[model samples]
Target: MRSLFKTVLDQTKPVVDEGPRPDDKEAGIVSDDKEAANVSSERPPSSDGDDDSINKDAQPGVQKMEAITKVWSTRDLYLAYFLIWLIYFVDAIQQGMGTILTPYVTSAFQEHSLTATIGVASGIIGGISKLPLAKLIDIWGRPQGYLLTMCCMILGLVLMAASNNVNTYAAAQIFYWVGYNGISYTTTVFIADTSALRNRGLVLAYTSSPYIVTVWITGPLAQSVLNGVGWRWGFGIFAIVTPIVCLPLYFLFAWNERKAVKQGVLVRQKSTRTAWQSINHYFWEFDIICVLLLSAGFTLFLLPFSIFSVQKYGWRDPTTISLIVVGFVLLVFSAFWEKYWAPVKFLPWELLKDRTVCGACVLAAVLFIEYYIWTSYFTSFLQVVLRLEVWQTSYIANIYSIGSCLFSIPVGLAIRHTGRFKWVALYFGVPVTILAIGLLIQFRHEGTNIGWIIFVEIIYAFAGGACVICDQVAIMAAASHQEVAVVIAIEGLFSSIGGGIGGTVAGAIWTGVFPQKLKEYLPAETQDQWATIYGDLTAQISYPVGSATHAAIVAAYDDALRNMFIAATTITIVALVAVTFWRDIKLKDFKQVKGNVI
Candidate 1:
């Protein structure tokens, strides 16, 4: 089997038909004294005039703009990009539907403790499921693994649509988890294959831009639909379309799978391994420590946020909150255990130690937390403070997606050309943090215009979106070539953890502060009714509250939003400081240097 593996790799290794030639002027090798000098020096020497032109082309401004145009015009790349985006869109719709239908699900199964725990169970199980799936991608080719996962998602959605009880719904989440991991790995592997070293950064950026966009765009529609009809239909709609649309597209644009076999991308092919074999042989050589650290860090970070809504405070019940706290502690312990005791670490220890990589992780985590808080709880602010309708809220959310789309390509180009990512981080990230914080502080005031809100969000989105691209480039630069996939997986895991934590934190803060703020604003009689409506803002905020209670409810919502924003701002500042200290490693010369930052 080992011999066969070696044979396959030898046969597939790319060969350059054009071979070496004469050191002096000779046939087939346009060689001269200077050319000979270039070979000896290990640098491509150029004439003085060519050097001048090259210098001009490499200028920060000119090259940045050129890279931007090249990325924009690369239509062939968009096929894979669009497919992944569409799949994410479907996932986004599902997420929105879950939020929108929370009220209905609560009402339908309120009596059953098991039923009430269904959604929570689904999230935890799904997260745990991803680790094994990650291993599978390392073993099986990414494309085939991804196709199989899509099938799993489609099947899960079908089951979810048919489910009437909480148990089945929980099962659906597990299945959906399997599918999501598959598609994500597929898209990642595909992009890596199709893109060249020169444009790799842009390819990654192009693929990821849609991640935030799809959810925001589809979330509101799902919310609107849930309000108009029932939530079951939302899942049903996806189940019907998954096979018809997403599945076929997965195969049609399945470029990654074919390329893997053709080139033998990984060192070993599974055809030589036993059917029952594990993927240990194909594991990333040195990224284990970082992966473990990130995964654990996120698990710890996620727990407190996940149970924010259910935790107890001064006046609230402590039962759920205590349980959540315990869960969070367990997650922390797990991280520690993985960091200290895991026999085979999944994270790269050295990379984590690198100032640049560490700083990038902190920056990405902080920025993501801000993004999540705004995303998860902004709807509450819209409904509770401004009294917007569900449809109206959805309409406004589109601004964020639009903003991200507008900024993504430009940011990708800037990093590719200038190789000056730290400046880009400062330029875009600082303003976004400021706007987000300012909006929160001013939100509780008298002159909160809708147009102003829209304007701020657009500005925030543009800056934030650009910062994301810049940060990803930095992260890629901070790792070695062999660690690229592992580092990306680490990034994805941490980013998701940041979002999860932010969501939970916002929920916790909102729930903790809501009652006290309500006491200050609403009449006792109105408070209980408002609490139920608050659970689903799209259902209740747009309608008029009586003159008596309106001011108070609005003020309370603003106060809660203000606190969350302040928290977000503080984290962003920490992230910025972290970025300032990062060791700037230029990635444009990756081909020349066999490894990246470390």
Candidate 2:
């Protein structure tokens, strides 16, 4: 572990600045560099104080935005990291339980078919929020962002426990994900702020280590909640426990911020702009309008597919047609806005052109698309087909995350050892992903062995660990120290988008095809109950294993999952191709982004 987590301050003398050579741009390869150096060192400065970070134009929050730049002792970081991991630990259990109850929560409204739509809603909302959250932490500082996002998380959990309809549940999911992803984004930024460039991926990968411990416990924990208090309490308990766990971390950041202020390390700079001017300034700065346009466009366009299945008018559904049309228009408008008239660009044109950065972005998007497409409703499938207990189903379902978390340890070590990430991703990640998807496709058949399903999941998890850590490293590599934090915020944006699209597609398939498949597979007498079974997991799993109804339900599930896996498999192949676009940048050092007050 020590080999994996290199000492941050061990080599304090600045890394020799070997900036990318000219041909590196032409090759889209780093040459002596590893990947994306497309990032500019320019940054929006702190409006609050006279600070010495580069790019002094007045804009957002802290100078150099380095929380640890001149802050307190090594003891402070050690305590802060302890508190950070503690938050991660509670967060793991909270999020894990929340995921377990999502399907049931939707089913309470008899809208289980719309389950994926919830993810679509949440992922899109959650995904786009990362940039804004990043901007927020930039402007307001880390502790403030921490408190704000945590509040959102608690609110979402409370609402989830009390939600009575799909609408409320969906909205809660969006809020929850926004906060969830925000917390994740902030922590990653914090890690970058603290760790050296070379060790960034190593530490970032370590963040997922909690999942390794939590994975083994989440299954039994979820099962106990389900059997004892039912699913509502499952979500409710997290809301109650999370604050107790997270508030200490908040106090740590807040107190350190105060100390930094008292010590003159950070001084608040007062803005002279009027309220409206400040609003307008930030409006363009954060690129909110563009985000809204893209979010609306993406949501409207993809959402109709699933809702289309539920609407009685089908192809003639005016609402569905109108949404798709409006969505298309918005999408086009967003493209032109981004290209021509937007005040601030969300991603710079050069970065967009960088194959390494683009490759990483594309990988994030497609990986999520492939994952959400198949995994939504998977728990329901497991319980029905494999006749597994709630705990048993959870263990199987969580294999991917557990495997990824565990594998990340080695992948992190390798990056630390070789100072390279490309070969690991290209050689190990892609092949394993393909194999996992192929196995998934094979196992979706009825009467398939459950072990094969779990096997594929473990493999998928391994791929996720390898691919994810590498892509993130690739993204940050392209950034100058100045632009690194910005890149971190937007890193998961495409993933969120991909997840949203994938979930929508999943809903479309399940709602449109699963019921039909249910009709096709179920016996004549059991036919009318297909709707009931589709809406209720308990109903699906209630019948005797060998009985006609039970077999029919399992067959219907197998059929639906088959389509999902087929779609997921196709997307996985695209990810394999997409990954090739990344230059094989070796992980050598963190961006020292010149011009800061360091």
Candidate 3:
């Protein structure tokens, strides 16, 4: 029966009516089956008229998308990164100047505690603000939130630029802090939205390169501007330039959002409840115990550092007890909130169960302390030890920033190809920590040159850049793809806390211990005279004073800063050992959404 059916099918097949074509006749071409099948499956090729209509209707979207994709891939997306970094660079200068000008600010304002308290407040504010904003990104959309943030930034900078009193300046810092925190958090979310997991590690690294670039630029730029123009002008120029540079990018991003929606690459949503619910659901569905343990581990680690400066007895003091108590409360709450309190927890509890997340956070917090000290004291280090003029000191400081900007892109790209950021963390972070510590030891000798400072900076900056990339990659690897934004936000939240603590602790070392060390290094009569002379440097440096005691005090201040770096390095070593225990997270591409989330 089968053979008979096949035979009938062959006979019934339409024969080719080869008219005058001898080639078609000789080939015995069957016209019916193959030609009909092809015609049925594929649309006919477009005519000229059809092509024109399609092009006319789709041209704007296609062109815009092409531009957006190009920008998204490497252009405008990075533009956001660059702008944020630039903002941070100028802000870093302002903040660094605040540190360098600490004595100046105290003298000018007639209050030392004022500057210290303000600095502490800024740190705390920057950290606390990120938590809510991270959650908001899913609801308000990144672009809109970012626009609000930039506007706040401009207002804050303007306030700072115009302020004449310490009270006014402090208020300006509040505004600046608000803007800075909001913009930073949203920009991270924007990066997560645009890049997939496969390329995200490198892309995020590229996006973050600007931070290193800005750190290099801001310090020297502020010093030169302060020396040549004035401190007021330093703030003024950034206030003017930041908006002009950042505004255009902000508008361009808005246009990109519209393009994304039109292209159907982005879905417009009226409610973000579902996304929130998604996160909360994951928490209940996963390991609640692990969340609490991880939170407790980090809180324990962070509490000692954060309050070390503000407490009366330092880390070993009785005050540490009170801070630990508060930290424990917060730690317990964080676990409970994430695991059970929310209708759905935003953080994936399973990722916290993995040793990678816990280890990365540990290393990241440690690596961040290095940056905190570097930014806080580069000016003091140069001006005091080298006895260089403000401009000369600031000029040397640029080497670190330059190293970071130059290396961020290549390092980020390299990590994408290697898929082994854990090793990058070790290679960059461990050595840099050692080099930083070594510089401190060298500073103990009176013979160390300013060139050593510059060289150490270059090494430290490269290490800092690589460490940042590794932490980011590690965070992504630990979390499921859908939780990428939350993961980044959480990491950032922890980093901000780390930076705050590092800066405060460094400040405590300088303010609390340095004066004692200075006395130990010099005789009492000379110390009293040196202290008196140091108090009036602004007036003395303005005149032609050939005082040798002035130089010694400067040297002592340099020694104090060197000690801070050494302490920072010790913290980094702890981070290094912790990272060694980190388990590698093997990430699948975003397209493979089939896997169980975390």
Candidate 4:
């Protein structure tokens, strides 16, 4: 299967270097002077350098600087890793807060229906932001991109803290989601830039280790804040702390950029064109139209899931039908534009022609889809079905993260030592994940043993950790340095799309099926209370342990979760199939791979 995809990609698009080849002295640098001149001419008008220097000396100087900049000392690499880890740590805390905020939103705003709607919106915004953000990172440099994301995060957090209505909160999430996705995508690019392929997997895995502390602490901390100060303070405190903690990283990046310049390892270009020309350049460069089309298409397409669920007529509603149809049309147009019409392509069709990159993306998307299907309802299952307390449910939920954190470093080190990732995906990740999901389906019934649930989660987490690291390493190993960031971003885009779709599918299933099942299971006398029971998740769990109503609700939840788990298990099997097509590319230090450095 893997060979088949490779053959097709090779025939469809010849695998040629998009940038300078290793043998070229200017390899890994920007395009040649003629190409650069053409690019500059097409840019929005900006201040330009001397024509004579650009014609004679500038290109050569730029080439020289690129070559010098490619060389990094051990200490420099360590500092870069430290910065990535630090940023990831802060991100984990923010994400943890987000996990708890759904319930808080439900309680504070008394809008239980908006919970899934907000998630879909966030996914849509985040997914759409990646395309332009990735290009901006490549064009503007990583530091500037990282700082921009931080600024957005701070702004969003402030808005969230101040928000008094659902509209304000949703608006804040749009900003925060974009910032979160941007920062994450930028960090991956940074790691790819700094780390050699041989150790890249390990570095990426280590970056996730902060989840160990953050995942555990985030729940309790958010709960405590909600119980004591208020949910508003939960957002306010992070708004204040994030900037302070992130300032050092801003300095670190600035320092690195300056050092590169001072060492003659970076050539800074001065724009000499008009402001309008500069604006035009950025528009074309970032491919804004494509971004808008894709974003609008996805947002419109996926939003109907949550919207229809909340609406009176559900999927039969005219608005829902129109959204789905129009969204599909827009997506088709965007694909057409990107493939055949766009001046600049956001999807990286060239690199994706590689079998490993394509396969890894497929696998990642499928896995994420599988993950979200079950995860979308995991907390509800624990609280409503098994009747666990918030702390207990949180502890159970953290098992996945904890398992992944514990095994990620070891899995990465193994890949680093062995230089083989495909077998890991094939032999360990696929099988373990399948087995875990299978067990989850079998055991996820009302009154199932808590121990069994924990066991399945642990196994699932470990396999997930291994698969994530392996997929990243495979993709990065297959790509050139110039393509690394975009490739990762593209992979993230796929995952986001998968997540959005998964959320929709899962939401439809739960909203459509769960209430019906509850009605069927509950006594006729209790049918009158369906609205009350379904509307308040807290109220569902608050029923007395031995009460008949509580038992009936628990049974309904178990049945609903069983169906979701079955869907998840089915989706996971596709990931296993995807793994079969993943090629095991030999990992090498990027510095040692000729023409591969940036």
Candidate 5:
């Protein structure tokens, strides 16, 4: 039986890389296209290498991917692995410490409610940038893409540390998320570029291993940083260390290009078009117009929902109505443009049209939505409401990550050994996820023990871990090497949109609803203090535990957070529906997208 849904994926043609399940041949999706064939036959815009010593024993149809994989020797490949692990390590430490501090930073500006607003910006940036970055790497090369993203990350960290207000901090966050998404996408594509199908999941899991070590230490580390020179330095420290570690990887890529050129094994192509032609070329090639349309439409449509009731005129505000109307108009036009008129289709329609690819993307999207809705402010909730120490709260907050990272390895191995993930994800992951989230919703009440929270978090983590692995492999199994980059980028595209929606929902409920709840629940004497408590984490926590004011505050939080959890749990069932559409692909060498990767 075929799936009842469809989604977009695939590059125009294919390089002889990994691809969709053999059973999907009837989709007639993977065909030779002119542009893709050209890429495989000719040198790219930036050449890595073309050593005859490499790919001397090449398969008949794998020239494009072969050029990349065979260029690295066994030792160089190991070094690339080390570099990949090092980057993930550095990023994990930065995120671990930085995430705990975001609430305090917003509180410092008396706009603690704006944290989800910041997350909205992050989700949007993460969504819009992946396709552009993928296009950039395809046109230029891996080295340039990595270098650009690293600079963005370092600058963002510096700006965040020096920020004087919520606006500036939000702006800094935009840059940071862009860089974060770019680096993340580049590394993921690198793994695909190097590995065969069988070990791909295992290799991806290995990159996440740093989180296991960092999660245990970061709680105390973040607490100390917060307690000492302040949250500014908490962000500032990463700015200094990121460049020191990242520069080497950039140099390694550049070194490869230079050596390949010197050995006469690489030829660099130079464009000869007029300036006007060049401008015209990239404008359409990068699809800048659609990017603008989507960004404006999504932000306008989503942000009004968040700020509507809090605005002076509530949802009746003229500006809110105008924004939504205009946003809808622009989005409809954008969809039409992509489907009919655009020179470069952001997603190739015919090349996609597969159940496995669509299902995997939907699965990834819903998982992120289920997570971000409640988690954006969970760390702060634990510290104030539960009255746990900072380190203790941080540990519990991080338990989700620890379980996910630890469990990813075994899930990956299982997929590799069995060459199947659909049953595992649909049968095991979905049920456990539902159970965990339900337990968590129940546990949010007053007087619940800390141990129960920890257990539920761990349960959610393992379930989430398996679901993610299955989603990733299932999606990749549906794209050939030529088509895989687009598949990966679109995966980010949909997932980040889900994140944006989750943030909007959480922010709307919290900003527009929580304040009212606070007013309603506060003790009579503390009624006037609701604004102070809402704006200041310090003031919120200053109240004695078990006091009427503190109890009231906890009650208000419980009500607001409960709504978000209920919203997320309902979406989990949709993920099971999404999983049903994936094809049970076999990850055999003949079906591998790329040459034998590490």
Candidate 6:
């Protein structure tokens, strides 16, 4: 066995260096001599106490070692960037499909509350998976980690396509979400690895800009599929296409790692320990128990709000109460464990102590909470209340994505040029977001202008795009190179918590208030049909446009949606307050930044 393994390794090793040799001075390649000269000339003199350590860490042989630790040549870097862009383009299409899938999936169940509840559950699963996946990417190398995510997504797509019940559908969602979040987390980390701080925002924006085209294409395509073929085909098709689109990039990554290993830029470490010992080591290093505790705590605490209204005794039910209480207790235990007991901490508590990171987290959480509060049932409202066709609703609903895509590149360029994100967040992002939310509240009524609604969505999208980009840059600037992926994962966790809470709260409001309002506005004679209308959305829109029942149902929808908009606006105000605390740290190269000080 050893001889066979050795033969395979020897064959895979490169026969010669891929770049210019160390002694080739005329080639302009970054050899050992040129690297030292460049470091000395390009790096600014150390002004702070941490500069010496930063300089030492930047030395060629002293960089934090990993399975693939080599810095790429300029040509290779650009090639990697192009490959990443293609990967994100495919990813965006899948996301666009997902946006339409929510309504289709829940419509199968014929329940209003299920939509938001399912979203909360999915968010919880996705959120909890980020930390482990981040660790995996850091430890296992990006190629292996990315392949694992793809496998999960493919399996999930198969499950969803074949699902015959809501339980199966939900299980499929859990797997897909885990893969989606992992992909997103790792992609961002890869971009960070390739680009410096000065150009990071622009690179990220360019990579993400494919969302614009994908949103435009997939929104109509998804609707066409739902209208003609079926939602199952949608999932199955993407499952087949994603691997085909992404496999080339995967092979390229593997090739790069092999070349780096052969070139001596990466050192291969062989493990001598037994298999059982290796498993034990990884389990502790990944802090599996803490992951479980956190996941369970979040799931239990947040899922109840999504279902409490439908429960027999509502909030007073024993199971509901116990779930919340026990969930909170376990959350507290997890916090203490990370702070005091864990041998290897998954969440960098010390980093969280930084003012910028803390503020960014709080702001991001609040923003996501606000965003989801109204969005949880937006497509349903357009379908049931406005009586729009699937295609029409999809076009309008995805305007947010279109607007975001349009503005992201510009915002990224502006931040890159200015080297500042705080002012942009405060003066532009916050006020515009609040204005958009307010406009939505005012215009979200029966007989309101559709054009105005579309405009509001655009405004919100542009502002949200700016805020999200700025927030990401700020957080990245605050973190060191080694911690970039983990910090981003932590930010994702906050967003997930916010999404879970928002979805749960929105579900409660939707399930609790919409039905009561409908009963009040609906005539007593038609009240007997309430169950039919509530159970099946199609039944709600079956009434004629100008009829009493139709008007009453529309009014109920308008009222409930108005309340949701107000809640979102109020929450965003809190986010604005959090943004005020964000410090304006200059976007310096990570190698130059010192000790969590920013």
Query: All candidates' TM-scores?
Result: 0.71, 0.89, 0.69, 0.86, 0.88, 0.86
Ranking by lDDT: 5, 2, 6, 4, 3, 1
State model 6's lDDT: 0.72
User: What clash count goes with each model?
Assistant: 12, 9, 5, 16, 11, 0
Candidate 4: residue 171 lDDT (0-100): 86
lDDT of 4 by residue, 1-598 (tens): 2342233223222111123224532211122344433332221111112121111222332232233234444445445556666777877877766666665566467555456566666676687677777777666667677789888988888998898888898889888888888888877776665455666677777777778777678778767876888888888888988888777766766676677668665667777979999899889878888888888888789888766766678889899999989999998999998888889877777677766778888887888777877877788778777878666777788888878876887887787687567888888997899889888887877788999999999999999998998888877766655556677888888888777777776776777777777788877777898767776777787778778888888777777778778888888788778777654454532232211221
lDDT by residue (tens digit), candidate 5, 464-552: 88888788777777775555666788888888888888888888888776788888989999999899898787788899988998988
What's model 3's TM-score?
A: 0.69
lDDT of each: 0.53, 0.74, 0.54, 0.70, 0.74, 0.72
Error of 4 at 346 (Å): 1.9
Tens digit of per-residue lDDT, candidate 1, span 233-302: 7777887877665665555434433433354431222257654453454443323544444444444444
Q: Which of candidates 2 and 6 reaches a greater TM-score?
A: 2
Q: Could you tell me which 10 consecutive residues in candidate 2 have the lowest summed lDDT?
A: 41-50
Better of 1 and 5 by lDDT: 5
Q: Give model 5's clash tally.
A: 11
Runs of candidate 2 exceeding 4 Å displacement = 1-64, 589-598
What overall lDDT, based on C-alpha atoms, would model 4 receive against the true structure? Answer: 0.70
lDDT of 3: 0.54
lDDT of 6 by residue, 357-461 (tens): 877888888888888899888887887666787778878888887787678777876876766678888888878999998888888777777888889999899
What are the per-residue Cα lDDT tens digits for candidate 3 across 231-264?
6666667677766766766687678767666766
